[model samples]
Target: MQRNPISRRAEAIHPSAVAEMLAMGRKMEAEGIKVYRLVQGEPDFDVPENIREAAKRALDEGYTHYTPNQGMPILREAVADKLERVNRIKAKPESEIIITNGGTLGLYLAVMATVDPGDEVIVLAPYFGPYANMVSLAGGILVEIPMVKSGSHYSPDLDRLSEAVSPRTKVIMINTPSNPSGSVMTRAELLAIGEMACRHDLYIIADEVYERMVFDGHEHVSIASLSEEIKERTITVNSFSKTYAMTGMRLGYNVANPSITKAMSKIYQVSARCAAASTQIAGIEALRGPQTEVERMISRYAERRLMAYKRLSRIKGLHCCMPEGTFYYWLDMTSFGMNSWEIAKYILSEAHVLVTPGSYFGGAGDGFVRLSFATSEENLLAGIDALGDALSRLQPTSGRS
Candidate 1:
């Protein structure tokens, strides 16, 4: 019998839907077709001037070599300070935090460090697309608990979540100011989850990369800061990509207890060794630098959010709640009688606009689509205008009103 070359593990994972859509947009652009891309979650701004200057200074000062497998001590101190001041999570720079190649790597490391084969991981459905893949890569079964929708926001059903916990459960993965959905978990919700984790002796992987992108007076709470017992079991992952417009920098970190940090560092030392030395230097400045630029960027996003929401809500057969946080609007597209993939492809072909199919996130995302407002106001308006035109031609199969 001939053996297949690819491992089952490798074949089980789906290709990134965001990357595929981005590639399609690029291909269309190359063919002289204009494509208005709203598929990715990337901020379209440049790295803050101060942080860029810090990187250039590091290069001039001859800081090119890898400092340590864990990361530079100065950078860790800055991260610790930020955590304490902003997140209210008192993490020790010396033993609790380990810088990784990026937030994606930080999440992967946390899963690998804690989950064993056959262990079950509970995740909120319609989560960040990568969470499913990461759990699968760790040889864990992903058990999704769908968030209940109320008005325009999605929230965890605490009773359902509590019922889903089992003896085989090992980790509960959460993302806030969630990707795709843009629901920032409230403090009451965080406290309940933290208490639940303590009761079940489960590890909590909190992805707070979008912590700073909240809007409409919604607060971003770090679950680990709720209590000492909760903090002990939580491995909080964050990155510079979303917060500081440093996506290309590939810098992020994880804060966990000493034991979990040690396990993650062991994997990091062999795989990535360390993030770029200069990137680490820049991250220090991002944490400690003046906040005027950050404030300006977020303020701009708020204005774009309002503009996009007003435009999107006016379209026929579409329903969207104002996003509470993050830069995305999770749209209910079921009224058009098309699945997410069909809707996305139709928009791409007819309107020359790119959107992420909601089904890419999970089974719960089947009839929805996500639109990002991370680009300029002109692009945002133009893309939505084209989208509105495309959507107007469709006849509704279901009555949403």
Candidate 2:
């Protein structure tokens, strides 16, 4: 039998670095290594009880059939209401929202609906890895604009961003409470970006999966809420995975203009049919039911963030900025005279701690490594202690002298 050739798109996509690290950690754990995993960006908590109950009730009621391509009307309306309540933006439920399998799928669908062949999509580095690969898959050029790092907070350079936009530029992808860095874009930054998007006639794909996970009195600003024009041009993507600890539920939705939503729904209908019915029901409950669970989870993550930051700061030659949001702490390893990949591998081998290499995000990430504080406090403290011991051995001469 002859093996079929893989498509170019399939060939273009690289296996996720986070997945690779997690797999390695699992192998080591299987072999009796006590691995402290800080790689994947998943919440350790269970799905909120109210959301789970909604899914259970749906199952018991036999609501297991396929729903509309755009999602259930109730879920869509609830999502729109959420946007209004949380972000202060008015969205039409029927024509402006498309439920997706996850925030990842929402991003892909947004790109597919907006990008033409050879069109340029501007992304800020260090971005989520899949953004570049997805652009390639959709036949769009991925134009990267590096973010300026000020300690731990990352701000998009508006001048550089303006330079990256040309007539061919179709979309700009923005991820706030960003993965790997946990940097939340300020309102002023969002306003600047919104102005650029309006001036350039470009669409903004705002990835707000970590909206509810902010810290230290920082606010998550939606670029779409900056103005009417920005709202018309922005596609805001959010998910239940991050906020509700419903990663396996595969439920998310996109808010955009009616035309864009229609186009995305067309792609969704052809490619995925619809998001899972039970998941959609769960999502509706997630939005409409009590939000106390989300607040509780955020509170716990905030505590973990503080614990991790304090521990990481004490390590010699390593610099960590207090993350304003999310469960990730980006550590600068430039002083270690090692690249992120080398540092990551060393930590795994010597300290039995798993982390994501920053280079996997982009070239700008070379001197950095990402640690997720999604585990229990005990594990977090233990992992930091192990890391401290490893770093001490590596830098003992300085103290000895």
Best by TM-score: 1
lDDT of model number 2: 0.89
Instruction: Encode model 2's per-residue lDDT on 289-399: one tens digit a residue.
Output: 999999999899988888887878888878788988889888877777788888898889889999999988888889788898998899898998898888777753222
Best by lDDT: 1
Residues 323-392, model 1: lDDT tens digits: 8899999999999989998999898888898999999889999888899999989988999999999988
**Which clashing pairs does model 2 show?**
none
Those runs of model 2 whose alpha carbons end farther than 4 Å from true positions after fitting are 395-401
lDDT of 1: 0.92
**In model 2, how many backbone clashes occur?**
0
Off by over 4 Å in 1: 1-4
Model 1 shows how many backbone clashes? 0
Location of the lowest summed lDDT over 10 successive residues in candidate 1:
1-10
Error of 1 at 398 (Å): 0.5
